[model samples]
Target: MTAGVLDEAIKKAAIAWISVGDGPAYALWCMPAESSILVVSGPGEQFAPGLAEAERATVRLRGDHGGLILVVDATVSRLTPGSDEWNELAPPLATKRLNASGTADELAARWAETGCAIVRLTPAAGSAVGAPDLPAESAAQPPRETPARVETRRPFRLHRVRKR
Candidate 1:
């Protein structure tokens, strides 16, 4: 896809799931900025521990089609706090994070206080692909009915008494 289209898609996508190697991945609350993807990892959020040392990963973008728009082979980089990069990226990150916040100052302050780090992913071989197809039968089944009563008030007895 063209850079313009890619940027637009990333900007509109609110969440992206990142995968490294064959390990399990977690969702990222990320946004498109400066030709890269910016995501935050801290307390009370979902993020893979591997990303801290990962060299490359794939960023999955759910497409309008019934499939995924995968941006493959993205180089992972961490943006240090209080740097020029952080200063510029933080505003857009805060706005995207608190998408509904009337003001960003409070959220930004809280983010700093809570020690949040912004990780950047630069697409090396950006690609879009179809989502894996699964049979309808494989879908989750509804819960089955349960018994009406689970316990009784009578005390437990190890042995039954003979007719008395």
Candidate 2:
């Protein structure tokens, strides 16, 4: 799916699941937490496929400690499976709509059809855990291009009177 499409999906899901405002369309990031998962959506190119594919289909997430897989649905205005967009929004996180109930499989299936995927986070096994850190990996990466700067020039220019 296209980055924009995936971003829209994430934003919608986040709004549905979490009580977050739809500030802008961007890539999504999440990490394990003590109680709930910490998620952050930002502007980015796309996600990883293996991540997206695994999330799209039903799959259990296992780690050294333990992990929870939340079924989520993310759809943008346009997203086609195996398209460039899909490739970009790879390695999608499995997130569920806030206050959603029912079986994980059911939720995942529903989301998958809409071009969204499931994300499973595995905690470090056998370790006493606290709150999970937010995933800032993407944040550290530089933008592909810098936005253009606007220049405000004076409406009129004054010539030197004495020089002439």
Pick the lDDT winner. Answer: 1
TM-score of predicted structure 2: 0.25
How well does candidate 1 score on lDDT at residue 116? 64
Question: Candidate 2 on 25-120: residue-level lDDT in tens?
Answer: 233444333222333221221233344332222111223333322222321122344555434333233233334354544444444455554333
lDDT of each: 0.68, 0.32
The CA-based lDDT of model 2 is what? Answer: 0.32
Query: For model 1, which pairs clash?
Result: none
C-alpha TM-scores of all predictions: 0.64, 0.25
Error of 1 at 55 (Å): 2.5
Which sections of candidate 2 miss by over 4 Å?
Answer: 1-48, 53-110, 126-139, 145-164
Candidate with the greatest TM-score versus the true structure? 1
Please give, for residues 47-152, the per-residue lDDT of candidate 1 as tens digits: 5667857788877766666245545568899887677887788777777674434455566556667776678988775454323432233322355345774766
